[model samples]
Target chain A: MGLQNAINGIPLEWYLIVAAALFSIGLYGVLARKNAVAMLMGVELMLNSVNLNLLAFWRYLAPESAAGLAFAAFVFVVAAAETAVGLALIIAVYRSLKSVDPETLTQLKL
Target chain B: MTLQQVIFIILAIAVIGSALFVVTTSNLFRGALMLIVAFFGVAGFYVLLDNGLFAVAQVMIYIGAISILIIFSVMLTRGMQAMIPRNAQAGSVAIAAALLFLILLLAFGPFRLVVDLSGVPILSALFRTESARVLGGVPWQFANREVPETYIADFGRALVDLNQFLLPFLLVAFLVDAVLAGAIYIARQRKPAEVIAEREAIAKEEAEELAALQPQPTAPTLPQGAIASTADH
Candidate 1:
């Protein structure tokens, strides 16, 4: 019984904590990384963490409703679109600038 | 701990470690590979959550498509991998991220421990175990019922149902279509001849615009019937 409880009793908080940590790591990646592609990878990590949070809440709080699942599916669509467009933009920028480093693009800087 | 908890812990460690490697690695190609590992870990998480559909979707979309796209982009910009890995503010960003993690932990974790900080009365007072206000601390509504056996089917139906998610579903499909076209448009490599032709076309259009804006002083304006007079001559 104790083992069963331990197995099933993985509280919602654990998932939340993991997702939060992932989000923070992703934020660090986005802010600290100079490579634009690396920054996009960070964005992907953050999105994945958010999806984890959504699915956790869905399973724990409202498994009966399809709302959480729908939201997650939508997030998946948005992430796909984001990845496609982001990578395309990065490739385009690389073609013009001959570099993938974000620091080298200083045209917008005052 | 139970089997599930052990599995969860291992998966969490793998995911977080690979994610860190993805961000911190100097080699962009290695970073892309680590990203695939992290993605697989997240898929394991979905399985642990008892959602096989999402696990499959995660594998198909993230691992198969997105990761491949990232790898292709990394290869397309190959010479950039040798640059310095981090920006100047990396140290400060690390501190900010740690602070953010601490705040997130307090907000989401089961942080109900009463602790005494040594040699810091003010900090101890502030760290007093008050009920964490968000997430795990709140008495949120929980449907304790088992998920329906037809859960996946229900999710599919919900997406296409008129009153539920049909509109958003259609909108997302449209968005994907537009994104696909836009990506192709933006990423396609134009030949030099095509580029020259486009520039020449633009220049011609501008010249026509200028001519229309200011009539030429040396040109004679022909009358309405001047074509008939010229033909007679």
Candidate 2:
């Protein structure tokens, strides 16, 4: 079969390329998307792309060290906590202003 | 041109498309949904890279919790369906674009192809004995095995091992607890009167909508002689 080579089925650089592209796309979202909640979603995407880069390096190059894998695991916990607090704050803002637009809340009125 | 490469290409496209949709869409609800799809694609990438542990974690934490929380916020806020054109700050968009272009130039630059590939054993069978060095990383001496077999076990051991990662492990737990308490305290800081007032306002709004839905019942005229003769007749 021409499929399923045990090692090097794909190059490490390809993974990096894709990960970098994904990260850039996420950056576009973060800076461009107007809604605050969507902006947070963009942040999650960027964080995830970073984790992908870490894990790709670990799996392909440094299989012996657990450092990269451990770092990715830590990122998971941080992302979860961040989302919780971010969403809670968004809800609080919505309750006060009755809107979630990022432009309207320019001042620290709330 | 192997089957694995083919699969990787497809996944990369799916992931990029969904991620682009997540940011580009004006409908906030649709953006959240696209985010879920993008997260699933990332989990699939983890599976491709043989990190089943991270794949499960990705799905459980990102799709299970974060995406749902975002959708809930979108639903709770008004104007979820009404598409609003983003008031894109031109300066910020320009900055984000320039930053992305620089990163792409650095990453996909011409110099990357000239780098030596002698160290990685899995990909380079001809140079099995030599150590392979990638950018900014320690030279990896060829390990005895190819793909790691004990990933799940290794993760558990590394997580609990006192000398290695125990401190950060405990710190993460503490930080999560702090976030929980802080989120609750911060979100509930509204005064009691304000809370009651918001509740009443929401209730009144819903009641008005309900009233608008029902037709006013016309007054039924009493029977001229027999006050509405009988229930049976």
Candidate 3:
């Protein structure tokens, strides 16, 4: 028994609830924010919640098999790549129009 | 009432509070800063879940890299924090999210009634079984869900094993490389005018430094001479 052992472990439901709430917040950002960068930020938050769900399930349901853990790590890799590409595209657009607002980017032009 | 629960609650607050600010805050830089805070909470989650490696990686990647990349984009485009935000759609966004939350909350149900739902019998059986298998593959025997040791080793084995997790692992590697190349190219497509301006600034600085190293009398003439030499007329 260690320091973490003293407290009864939280039920898996609590973690899931938190994950759900975070995900909803992210969804709102993606929907409401006109800035492309802000929308991307929302996507990042959603991905974070997904990772939380993954790790929670891994810790609560099957810490034996490494499947859940592997999936979570894979998610991080995918997120990093996605963020890199997203930011680059945003920069390219900003260079052209001097703005990152999504509404103004309705049509592509030279 | 226990310490674990207390810590979990605190971490949850940090994560949720900062995440809310990340979207709601008008200042892009401030939003990015809040995002960093939210990512910190996620790192804390990894620690609580007993994966020290992932906790470190989360901090390193999310905070050290992704957040910085986002902020750099904000700064490069112009200080996005200074611009007035378009928040007209916020109300509708909130309403949509609230609707989604209610739907999921009910679906999750109390007392983990998800298993009782008839729509997802396969899901129920997977969670209820001793060892989960897809299409009844070789069954993994039930084991402790909290064994903190051997996690990194097991993760490595799972990733490389040809029979199980190899495909996704390989795909992840390939995708990362492809994205890295594409992002670098797209972000580095510097416009010709900006490139010329940058070159001019560099040349001006170099000329100044060269003039400073020489005698005062010679220095004045050198700048004028260089300017005159470079002039098209």
Candidate 4:
């Protein structure tokens, strides 16, 4: 209940709430932004929020286990790699159309 | 609230507010900038969770690398005048929002969170004692024997042993190289010479049309009173 007691300092549910808010915001960004690059940024934000939740749970529930740390590291690396490829694809799209608007990119239509 | 909890609340507010701003801003550049701030806030959360390494990595990667790359791509592809369109599927957005709200309720609404505040004091005590011993240059006692300072060396050597992360590290290198090659190939193929030629032809046609629209005078037209003035002279 006090600052001196680490056990009851901050509730785990608060972290969960923050994580949920972050995820929802990310979803809204993904839905609203038409630029492919912006969409990719939203996806990254979503992934980061998920990772935060995982790390928070790991630290609170099982601090002794190194698995959580390892998993978070893996997620970070994967996120970086995914963004690289995604941004490259976005660049390719821009080069072709001179614009990055998703609505105008309709060449795949039959 | 306790100081720790108070700090956490402030950080959570910063994180959530910046994330929302990043999502809702119409300017793509501003959104990217807000994303960097959001990343820093998240890293602060990481530090509060006692993960200093992760905090550093988050700042270095998300703030430094990923955000910069996104901003660069936005600038390269479109000028500042480009407007980001709003959501196209209102129905789908409403449905997704409903689902997200339900999930949040299910995940956090019913659970009571318990925090172990006493653990922090105990950890602080143990860390202080250990640090005092380390600073005093006293050898660590292990199995009733005084162990030398070479313990850290042994730990480091064991970490790099054949059964450890060597293979995964090398594999990551390979993956990065492959991604680089693929990106180069894709970039090269996106812009063909034919597209450039077509754009140039269109530009030339527009220029020619504008040139033809101008009045072509076979002889200079006299002013309204110029002929009368010459007759008077």
Candidate 5:
């Protein structure tokens, strides 16, 4: 019930393992989903996992320094911007092609 | 196991399971919802890591804004919800992802190389640690300390201080401004006639979907915003 015990009880490796699994799942989503929006969702998952890793490291190894938290914050902003631009591009693509499936939008295929 | 460990396990399971569902589901709408669940789990992790600020940020940013954008895109492209091939190389991709996970586990988990790779100059230089032994072959050699109460305030100062993250902060600010303007431009560039046509087509498609379903007495009403947007034509 001690605060220190609660904070440091969990091993850092657990966070890393969880992040790895999350990243892999996100990879599958990004590579396997044909829908552009679904792919974007996968990317978001990967970014979240990265944030988890950064923050976990910060907590376990370097809580005194603000480097990890600052990096994670930057990641948050980037993820937000990425989603906004990605969805906008998806919408534009759908408007032109009447679909969001990346497979059929092969106009750029050489 | 400690209470924190138990909570960690539960959070991890919830996150990974929902993430799996988000990736594998053919229904985009359902996937988006599950993605939000995964985000909530990650936010819980942030809280467990003793950083409540990020937990709130995770909920606000990921669940609030990003998930809404994803769901909106899902709705905007509705008819292709089901029956589309999820992917042609799904099996191969799954195998590849599993392999990648295994590799990551070996690197980050308990089953790591026994050799003291920290002796290598290159590895030592990368992690910026002196006399630090790599644990499980990962460059993780730092004594844990209790987080100071003023760490959040320190984080804010670090973000603005020129010697630290100010440059990146300003760059990100510029990036966000550009992204917002660009997104609005990209989404709004359609011709008036084209937009009207698409709205009508969506309405017609909804009617068709309803017709295909069992008849109901209640008619679907358009949103007031949709009505106003169309009226701008």
Candidate 6:
């Protein structure tokens, strides 16, 4: 898509749509992937997609609001820590059960 | 095509291909590797969006730390030679395909994408005219009504200062540490009792061998002499 809008020449909607697509694809991955690590990747994808949305809106819609950028940064940090601990738990589970398959991790399954 | 368009195409292709591989690969380790590629693709998208900070963080945190951790966990628990189960729903593949098609048909049917070409020139001008020092420089208080150009820096400062994120930040750190400690504890707890028993057995066998090797009384000469005398008689 060619440039369609300018808030003094910014294309905000395009970024938003792209972010939405990324988020949807991530959702699909999370639903379809069986591996816990892959699921974590999906979660990361979703988070990044959201970050993209936030940054885009910040740049185009609220150029003065540094808050969006700050939130994205915070999101990035949380994502880093989340994956670390999540993968650690996955490793521990694998050690005990010899598989990282989500189906086999039925300890909490009803 | 424009540079942005070309980069977008490449990143899109990378994202889709890697995502497919992540789902389709039978090997979990390979799947994890493909996930790294997908993350890289997303990070590229961040770069295209003019968020260089996010791009670097994506690679360093996701590709560098998380992917390696996943691979290590996979290797430690499952040997490289272990074969993951094949997709058992092979027979339902067609059904799934049909369902996916139906979903796409319904989803894309209603959406008409409107392209606006006028915005590009304005955006290009904004990008070209904006001073790097003002737009990308460190955050500073502005006396003017318009927001300062250092958006990212301002955002960073806000996180630690205005938004009161310090508590959540510390909480997240504590959570991570607790999880790490718990995982280590669990892994240590799962060591097979047989391993300890096997070590003890090996030690016992070594001790017995040492005892048997000790020096014995020298009766060999008497035995030889008795045998010779009996033969002569």
True contacts kept of each: 0.80, 0.58, 0.71, 0.43, 0.87, 0.23
Q: Per-residue lDDT for A18-61 in model 3, tens only?
A: 88888999999888887889899999999999998898777766
lDDT of 5 by residue, A1-110 (tens): 12232354877778889999999999999998888999999899999999999998899888899999999999999999999999999998888788888888889889
Question: What does candidate 2's lDDT look like per residue over B1-233, in tens digits?
Answer: 78877888888898889887887777778878988888998898888887788899999999999999989988987564564635548357847765874655453432342234664556556543333433322333333245568877887899899988999999999999999998897678778998899889989998998787654443335543355577547
Total residue pair clashes for candidate 5: 0
The two-chain DockQ for each candidate, comma-separated, is 0.51, 0.40, 0.40, 0.30, 0.55, 0.21
Q: Which stretches of candidate 4 lie over 4 Å from their true place?
A: A1-8, B109-172, B188-233
Best by DockQ: 5
The CAPRI classification for model 2 reads as acceptable
In candidate 2 chain B, where is summed lDDT lowest over 10 consecutive residues? B135-144
lDDT, candidate 4, B27-121, per-residue tens: 87887888898899889888777777788989999988889988888787765236644657734764685588556745464342223333466
Residue B189 in candidate 1 has what lDDT?
A: 89
- Over B156-203, each residue of candidate 6 has an lDDT whose tens digit, in order, gives 666566355656656666776876776566555544687677668878
Clash pairs, model 2 backbone: B119-B131, B119-B132
Instruction: Give all TM-scores, in the order shown.
Output: 0.80, 0.75, 0.76, 0.69, 0.81, 0.63
Clashing pairs in 5: none
Model 4: how far residue A103 lies from native, Å: 2.5
Leading candidate by lDDT: 5
Q: Please estimate how well model 1 matches the true structure, expressed as its whole-model Cα lDDT.
A: 0.86
What shift in Å separates residue B136 of candidate 4 from its native position after superposition?
49
Q: Could you give the CAPRI-style class of model 1?
A: medium
Over 4 Å off, model 3: A1-8, A108-110, B82-87, B109-144, B191-233
For TM-score, candidate 2 versus 3, the one ahead is: 3
Question: Any idea what lDDT model 5 has?
Answer: 0.87
TM-score of 1: 0.80
Q: Which stretches of candidate 6 lie over 4 Å from their true place?
A: A6-10, A107-110, B79-149, B162-167, B170-233
Candidate 5 lDDT, B1-233, residue by residue in tens: 78878888898899999999999888789989999999999999999999999999999999999999999999998967875647889899999999999878876776764446467878767665543445454456554578889999999999999999999999999999999999999888767898899889989998999887845544345566688889998
lDDT of each: 0.86, 0.76, 0.80, 0.70, 0.87, 0.63
Ranking by TM-score: 5, 1, 3, 2, 4, 6
Better of 2 and 6 by lDDT: 2
Better structure of 1 and 3 per lDDT: 1
